[model samples]
Target: MTGKTVVITGASSGIGRQAATELADRGARIAVVGRHRARAEAVAAEVGGVAFIADFDRLDDVRTLADDLLFACDRIDVLANNAGGLVPTRTLTVDGHERTFQSNHLAPFLLTQLLLPRLIESGARVISTASVANRWARLRLDDLNWAQRPWLGGWGAYGTSKLETILFTEELARRTAGTGVSAYSFHPGFVATSFGHGSPLMALIALMSGGRYGISVEAGAVPLIELASTLDPGFPSGTYFDTLTGNGRRHRLAGDADLAAALWQRSAELVGCVPAR
Candidate 1:
């Protein structure tokens, strides 16, 4: 992977940070992206790469980041849509969309869409960090933003966003079937990362587990690294993985084909982009 470029969002912390380090250690040119400029730069410095600062809450920022990344990197071999988090409160972004929905799903969707051409040209691979929370997702497709009920909590919203991640991966793989680029989403497992510290349930788990059950950030990043670097012919597309295993033990509604397609269409409409044929 020497000289190959890989762009990782949310690289300032958690699994994304570990993935960036591992990839860079393996000789891949890394583009570390984060909302905080200093933290992003720190991570990039550690990885011998460049830092990109972008606020995922703003679509314009995401667009500009994509353009800048393409301009800076001659070729992108991997794109990891890892910049996401759970918002404790139901807030609206500047785009008038739910914060969690926009940050965890829409922003990555837009970034991936805008960079698809460059990825195709470079024969790159796309990997997104989904979660086991997708199983708890009671997605109201008709009211995705909770604009009607408006009583949705943080955990539900986070789950819904992860469901969207899985769906987007499936549909993207279908759209780019014959193309060299392949997209896959996966659950990094229950790592003791700073992913859901704001939630009571997450806090409870952290308390109860006493840090035993929870895995390390390095372990959580293994599946993503494998998906990005592996040349295994048997690696399946439009599938969800858990810790590098292909077992369906943790499969959920996130892997539903029909829902994946619908989510793809909805995402395309949201981003104002046509799905690849």
Candidate 2:
């Protein structure tokens, strides 16, 4: 990984932070992105890397971050779309989309599309952080906004968005074939990170687990690092992994080629970006 440039979102803390530090120590040039500029700068300084600030809730922020990255780095070896969260309520962004949908799926979708050319030139690897919770997703492809259905907290919405994340990886890998860019999605296991801001249950779990039952941030980040660094022979693309166990599968919907294609088109339309050919 030496001399390679890696960009990781959500690097202010948790798995993102662990991955950023570890990658930097291995001599990869790191760009740490966070919602908070101060936190991002702190992490960047620690790793002797650069910092970028972008809020996933806003598409404009994602666009600006892409522009900044393109201007600063000529090549990106690894792009880890690791930033995501679960909103407790059904909130909407200025883009008029559900908050979880925009943050988890659309933001990274746009970022990857914007950087496609560069990723192709560098033969980059794209890694999206998915979770086992995707099994909870009951995809409403017809009503992605959830406006038609009554609010049921935000877990359903969050899971659905993650399902989209996996689908996006599948579509991306398919589209970028022979372009030297590959995509991967993986479940990081039950990580002891500060995720899920709106739910009391998440807070309780974080507190009670105290990093006991849950895996440490370092352990949780191994899968991401491996995917970014290695391209083993016959390694599958457009696939979801259980963890670092050398094999994993996604939910049934996530593996549907037709659905992945449709979601890719829908997502491109929603984000107002052309899907990479």
- Which candidate has the top score in lDDT? 2
Best by TM-score: 2
Write down the lDDT of every candidate, Cα atoms only. Answer: 0.84, 0.87
lDDT of 1: 0.84
* Residue 212 displacement in candidate 2 (angstroms): 4.3
What value of lDDT does candidate 2 attain over all alpha carbons?
0.87
Candidate 2, after superposition: displacement of residue 98 in Å? 0.8
Which residue pairs show collisions in model 1?
A: none
For model 2, the run of ten residues with the poorest summed lDDT: 230-239
Query: 46-155 in candidate 1: lDDT tens per residue?
Result: 99999999999998999999899979988899999999988877889998888888999999999998898898899888998888888777687787786776544588
Residue pairs clashing in model 2 are 242-248
TM-score (C-alpha) between model 2 and the true structure? 0.95
- Please report how far candidate 2 places residue 105 from its true position, in Å: 0.2
TM-scores for the candidates: 0.92, 0.95
